[model samples]
Target chain A: MTSSTTEPIKITSKEQAEWFLNQYDTFLFDCDGVLWLGTHLLPRTKEILNYLTELGKKLIFVTNNSTKSRLTYTKKFASFGINVTEDQIFTSGYASAVYVRDFLKLQPGKDKIWIFGEAGIGEELATMGFESLGGIDTRLDEPFDATTSPFLQNGLDDDVKCVIAGLDTKVNYHRLAITLQYLRKTESVHFVGTNVDSTFPQKGMILPGAGSMVESIATSSGRRPSYCGKPNANMLNTIISAKNLERSKCCMVGDRLNTDMKFGVEGKLGGTLLVLSGIETEERALEINEAYPRPKYYIDTLGDIFDLTH
Target chain B: MTSSTTEPIKITSKEQAEWFLNQYDTFLFDCDGVLWLGTHLLPRTKEILNYLTELGKKLIFVTNNSTKSRLTYTKKFASFGINVTEDQIFTSGYASAVYVRDFLKLQPGKDKIWIFGEAGIGEELATMGFESLGGIDTRLDEPFDATTSPFLQNGLDDDVKCVIAGLDTKVNYHRLAITLQYLRKTESVHFVGTNVDSTFPQKGMILPGAGSMVESIATSSGRRPSYCGKPNANMLNTIISAKNLERSKCCMVGDRLNTDMKFGVEGKLGGTLLVLSGIETEERALEINEAYPRPKYYIDTLGDIFDLTH
Candidate 1:
């Protein structure tokens, strides 16, 4: 853990940047606001990535948005004229699949997960040899029959040992009911939410994200799902476990304080860099939850490091 | 308002029961647990009611379950071979309608409310000359077109100034999406939840109640809804406003601590009574939340009052 008693310092000087660069070999970058907003790439981020790559630094893209899989994110990176492989992306969905397979210790082929998300979550779990039930377009088409008590009705997939919730545009009552049924009817089923990011920054505007989806199941069921996203630091740990990286030689770079900064701080990485390119302004950063971990450093943008390169 | 320095006293004697019964001429009872378990009536409850009637005590039935309207509840009483008037019953649906009409101060026929519940909530709102939108049996039959964003398609009701949520068996993504759209997409829209009762006791088993139904909209919308059910004290206040009853002369009697006991306690009624005939067992009563209102007295059951009357 980063046992630093010191507060986050402003990374303004070249010497500070040089010292920071020398400390970490692996860098995790938060996409959306930090890298690009929607289709438009942020200024100097490409140059920064190229500079880091030239130095032979390991780069990983992390996002809480589970709507898109690594494959889709790869295309998203390419759309912005940035080169990022699917392997370099660590999504909440991917983390969730890993969590289910590893942490929960559910057998991939035998123990199934009822998914209240899109193909992104499904794809990741599938890649891990796990079957995902009722995802995206696979909505519950069961007609409401007043004559039948759905709880009393049999034929529900008894194999489902987990319910993983994510942002599903096609979320409906039947899906929620089925999920609740899995949680209620079944014994000892694990409830997982990919991330509870209440909103997502996209194209200069914030939109409702995964937290909304998780809220319903939690409220109705009177049960909170174990979240697998930023602020939890599971994503960084997952990367570390997979790649066997030096924990003390890694840094997390992001725009948001609550998730990204908290993730990095809790991970006890070499450093956490907060960029003001997204949701949290410098003024807003002053008022943070006392419980949350603070970033090690704050900068105006990822491009601010250009001064260091100069 | 029950300014008692004394903790809840056990009603173990006739003198204690006499002091309790004599304190409140107006007794509000929670239906499902206090009176009967679904279709089956509890032992000696009818006799206790008969004795209370002999003493000419004013009995009012209050419930947070918005699934059944006062008219439906009247029939439920009739099914139990009990005498009850529609006026004597106050359901969350009735409370919600009253709240919207009197509390929210929304102009009827001008400001509309989108209903995310059953016919009970709809009928109650209708009684108040208010228009209700979606409800039970009103499924969003629209097929998910992956190519299109549901929010972009026009045809959503725009005049809706409020979204009232309750125990909607027909709760689906479209309903939740519409609720979220109103809360997030619309401007200054009111969000109201009928109640947040997590579970309802039925014959031999407990099932998820309206609270579970409300959980989704609250979670997904990222906005907390104003509730009009038991423990909120609004139901009691609504009754007080309509009937102009003496608040000090009233007491709430039920099986649950969170809802029924809290209702009476917060209402500043004479006292609250807990009976061990329903959801909560005597052992569970020992672990009352310090934040919640406590009952003034406890007994084996509502039927246990027979010993006092005798």
Candidate 2:
């Protein structure tokens, strides 16, 4: 309903936790902040997920990190001793791959995808049977030479039908130069961004996220990319339709307000929950503002649900 | 003057050229597109500059290229057989250095300027007697290791007072990660951008400009950088004050309507001239719109002045 005026209900008691559990049949969780922090899983997070699964609630882990594919995320979950399958993980890389195929309806063999990102996007697209180029190419790491660079001399691959920009750690002038050429080429290929998260928490520090790469590409190409991540509604709808889940019966939980909370509220999910283990704090999130909607429920951490119930 | 409603005058006749020469005592010329196209000089450009110099009118080369310092630009001018001094060249690199030292009032030895750019910005800052770091550092080119990176372990330099972002061909994750660290440090650092030109013409192709780097840093740091290039009154005012010239007596001649023409119009310069030798075409420039001001005058090429007068 009206989220701006409504004060967020803090999940502190057992009755409140019981009400939350009974209200939603499905739960969407943000990975970086909600599920874990860096390499360490937040306390009681695994037990909470297990309890929710035992209660017959559907669980989906949504992450904006485009550097890792679904398989990589599944591996990360396995490492953390959390049983999450690849199908249950919705990374921006997987979402972009799905968008390129299903929404854009690109023919796999006929249409080629150009990547201005890391190996994650390429891996995801490859799994969907799409032939992609430019990701994790060591040649792009070399210093750009106008006279000698292969892209500059030999020209661009003409069959590239789409360009996907994501978090690229090895981003250099050579990579951006070739991407710009494809973006400005005749017959204007589709431009897509895996996500637009400005920064993500890395250990104890904040670092540039995939949004930085997307903005860089957008600036050079003078073209805005179609985003396929959280807060865009595209990714949420895709997940909903693929799993045949009702939006009214689903609850979204995340640590960030702009991406995760907005993703839930705008998508008209049943409820939105905020966890204080990631980028946002309880003080900042509770500050009533028009910029971002306050979450319906707030908890000290994602593990608070387990703590309250058990 | 209501430039949106007014049509740009095409200087085709000798009488019109004489009128233009009489109207302005000082001319601000954009280097890349106005004077030379890449390393090659346009036809009669040398002759035009010679004639203009002989006429006793002051000429200032205002360029948004931050990759090269004023000394480098002067050398470029010399290589082209054009007699020009370092003071005559006002590059974005030089302008940014001045902004940090003069406007920001950063004292030498006490305040350090961190550069997220090429050698040009460091060169300019060094010329001003300010100690700088991080520009063109080969160590940043190495693959980022969260565990082994020195910046991740030791933290950032506390003396870094300001961060200057310009066109950096060697930009990598390590560089951005370090810059983001300084920006998010307890003592906030001033963020400055050399220019905001989205793309620059490179030989035959267009590539990512300094603005792309600027936007990337801004997105990650969640801080907007103070731009010191075209369309921003800071650079124009700096030049005007340094030269002790009246704004009404100077005309800005450039190829791009957004930056060059907007700079002139917004700065309240005497007039603005558009040249067709660079990125823009006649058809696009002539299209009357409010987004960009119609130039007071336009020519087929910068050399048209020499042709008209001769």
Residue B195 error for model 2, in Å?
1.0
Compose the digit string of candidate 1's lDDT tens values, residues A154-211: 6557788899998876665556666776777645888999997866654433445688
Looking at model 1, residue A31 earns an lDDT score of 92
TM-scores of the models, in the order given: 0.78, 0.95
DockQ of 2: 0.81
How does model 1 score by TM-score?
0.78
Q: Number of the top candidate by DockQ?
A: 2
Docking class of 1: acceptable
Give the clashing pairs for model 1: A171-B173, A172-B172, A172-B173, A173-B171, A173-B172, A173-B173, A216-B216, A220-B212
Colliding pairs, model 2: none
How many clashing residue pairs appear in each of the predictions shown? 8, 0
Error of 2 at B192 (Å): 1.5
